[model samples]
Structure formats: structure tokens, C-alpha cells
Target: MPAHRYSELHTIPFYECNVNNRISIPMLINILILASEHQNEKLGVDQLYLIDKYGIGWVVTSYSIHITELPRKDSVVKMTTRGTSYNRYFAFREFWLHDQDGNELVKVESIWVLMNEKTRKITAIDDDVITPYQSEKVRRVPRLPRPGRIEPEDQMTSKEYQVRWSDIDFNGHVNNSRYPEWMLDSLPMDFLDTHEPTNIDIRFENEVKYGNRVTSSVVVDSSDNDKIKTVHEIKSSDVLSASATIVWKENKAEGQD
Candidate 1:
């Protein structure tokens, strides 16, 4: 199997950046996924090809992202993605964002699974679908670390959101990018304004369809003023849809807290 890696250069636009002129994590996530979409198109196994031919599509199950520095507005950065390995049920992939000088800015490790289009159930990866990426197949599946659990007894700040049509991707489920946005939005504005995430671990357990209402709940642990940890969960009709843990560092740069 040949190794297939893809990279693309992007200029950060103003809208993609936050109040501090740095690119937001959710937007960066979308860009990383766009890079993967381009790679699939290049390999001729894009969503359309797979769905039309095999009645299947890829869905993200989990992501572990590390942020060294967030790219600022108008900065040109290179985004790269590749399939590390896969098995019958899962595919492991990696993504990296590098600055103009080649310094790593962000790193993302992810797990993906194939889902049947009509049945919306997890499906096995077929040789025809997995072969084009040249990803190695293993009999033993990798054990990725799961997100820290959020106990029901923990006090939480929560908000309700109605899924909009735009939130649905081509797969007919909520876009993976929206999970972090919902999670982050549940935090207090002051915390979000004064802090930036350094590490993020999120797991998607169930799919949320358009028009469904979801409650985003968060628990903040501020015991460490410098390094804060926040636990987040998204639930619809009492079913847990997604959960995430974000580690943040205080932004020393002069700004509103």
C-alpha cells in the first residue's frame, strides 16, 4: 500500500477569526475536514462516489487536537492530512497545520467509521473503499483514549439549541464541526474571552438530525487559575450525543476578561 498524504495552503480570512484576531477552533476544524474532502476527491472516493456506489459515507467518531498557537487573521498556513491506518471498523487519520516558517501550529488525531447511508448504522470498511488511501489494515483495532466522564452530580451550566438545516452535512447528520461550537458557547463569555484552548478531546456517540433540539451542558473547573479544565456534554431527549474536555490557558495578551 502506497502512503497517500495531501496538503493545501489557506489564507485566514477575517470572518474565521475571533475577537482576538486568531482563528477559532471550530473554523479550523472545518478547514481540516475540507482538506480531507479534497484528498478524497483526488483519490476518486469522495462522499458522492462512495454514497452513490456503495451506499456508505465516513463519519468522525473522535478527535484529539493539540494547539501550540492559533493562526492569526490573514496568515497563510499549510494544512495536511493523511490516513495513518485502518481496520474493518475504523480508520485512523492525522491532520497538521503549519505556519509559513513550517512551525507546527495545530495537530489533530482522529478516528472515523463508515456508516450505511440508508440504515445509518456502522458498517465495515470494504477493500475497494479503504484501498485507495493506501492505509494499512490491522487485525487489532487501536484503543484511542476516551474523553473524561462528566458525572451527573456535577453542577453544570446548560443551554438549549435547535439544530438548523445548515448544521446538516451531506451525510444528513449534524456536522462534526458544530459540536465544539456548541460546547464552547455554553461557557461564560468572560472565560472564553480571557482563555484559549491548548488541548481538546471530544467524542461523538450519536448523530443529531436537523430540527432536533439539543441541550449543551458544561462544568468548569477553575481550581487552577492558569490552566482551566472544562467538561462539556451535548444531549438531545436525554440521550448523550457528544462529550468533550477542553484544557485552556489564560491569554496574557491584553484583552477583556
Candidate 2:
């Protein structure tokens, strides 16, 4: 069968950039998510369709993104996405970003699961549902390295965050992209100013709904401070909502990191 894919062009807006004037990691994630939504809409299996027809919604289980070059503000870029494969309860997707000249800048891989809206339990993906995307069924989907386990003693700092209405997505839960924002915010301002993230791997363990208070905890590697791992759980709660490992590189002069 022919590969099913979707592609679109986007201009980097000023709000999406950080102090360095390059596209921020969270914004990159949002763009890739939008691309996936667009593709699903074309295939008639989008959020609205699934929620209305199947009483289910898509929840991202994990994501891994590798950035070769960060797109600068005001630059136009093309993003493409496609459904790779699926099995039982899980589906895989891939995303790519390119410059105007078609030079690849970034690649992302993600895993998603179907959740029953009423029961709040994971449900098996229907063949009729995934068939529209033409995603093949695979024994094992492609994945990136899982985020490292965070030990209790390694916890450095923790901050509590109240989920705002703005953070909620159509599924009535905190958007997946928002987790990166929360994780990055837990870092000191100086660390953020001095270093930039090159690669990020995140795993979502549970859903965080609006009005939930979550605490983001950071754990820096003892051997290398540049490698930071964080875990976020609902405040005063034991449920682990998400965990991420971000590799940072010191920023250099003239837009290099």
C-alpha cells in the first residue's frame, strides 16, 4: 500500500521563540502535534470524530525528538507527519521538519493510546478506526530510548503548578506539549539562559486534568549536570503523570548551542 502522509508549511512566529530567538522546544512539539491532527482530520479519525463516534480519545504515551538545527524566528518551515503502525492499544506516528530548501532540521517519534472517555481506561484501537489512516499493524512499534528512572535521593528541586484552563486540550486533560513547558520551567533561569536542549525523551504515565495541581521534580545527573532528568506527579498525589530526560548543550556565540 502507498504510504499515507500529510505536509504543511508554517512560519515561525515571535511568540514561539525563546531568549535566543530560536524556536523553543515546546513550540516545536506543538507544531508536530498540529501536523498529526491535520493528518488525522484528513483521514476522518480526528479527535472530534473519535470522541463522538467511539467515545474515546487519543492520549500520547511517549515522545522522543532529536533536533539537528533549531529554526529561527520568522523562518518558514515545512512539517510533515504520518501514521507508522499500530497494535492492540498503541499507535505510532512520525514527524519531520524541513527548511524552505527542503533540508531536514528535525525528526520526532511518538506513541499514542486510546482512552475510553467515560471509564478513563485504555481501550483497544479498532481496526476500522486505524484503517482509515492506513497504518499497518506491527508486533512492535519503533521507539526512542525511554527516559531514565528517577531515584528518590536524586531529587534536587520541586515546584508546584496549578493547571490552567489554557493548558487543557480538547480531550479535557493537560496537553502533552504542556508537560515539556512545565519540565523546562522547573530549571533555574540561569541554566536555561546558559544552555539549550538538543534532545528530549518523555514518557507520560498518567493524565493530568485541568484544576489539578502537579509538582515537577528535577534530578540532575551527578556525573554530568548537562543531562537533566525530571519527573512530574500530581501534587500531594502519588500518580506519576510524566517523566522526561533532556540533554543540554552550552550555548555559543552567533546562534550556536
Best by lDDT: 1
The residue-by-residue lDDT of candidate 2 on 1-257, one tens digit each, is 74598999999999999888988888998888888888889888888899899998887888888887889999999999888898888899889999999999998889988899999899998998889878888988876678876676775688889999999976688887778888888888888887777788888888888888888877766375645434433232767888888877767683464
Q: Model 1, stretches more than 4 Å misplaced?
A: 224-226, 254-257
The sequence of per-residue lDDT tens digits that candidate 1 reaches over residues 29-124 is 999999999999999999999989999999889999999998988999999999879988999999999999999999999999999889989999
TM-score, model 2 to reference: 0.91
Estimate candidate 1's alpha-carbon lDDT, on a 0 to 1 scale.
Answer: 0.90
TM-score against truth, every candidate: 0.95, 0.91
**Candidate 1 TM-score to native:** 0.95
Question: What are the runs in model 2 whose C-alpha is more than 4 Å off?
Answer: 222-236, 254-257
What Cα-based lDDT does every candidate model obtain?
Answer: 0.90, 0.82
**What local lDDT does model 1 show for residue 168?**
93
Native-referenced Cα lDDT, model 2: 0.82
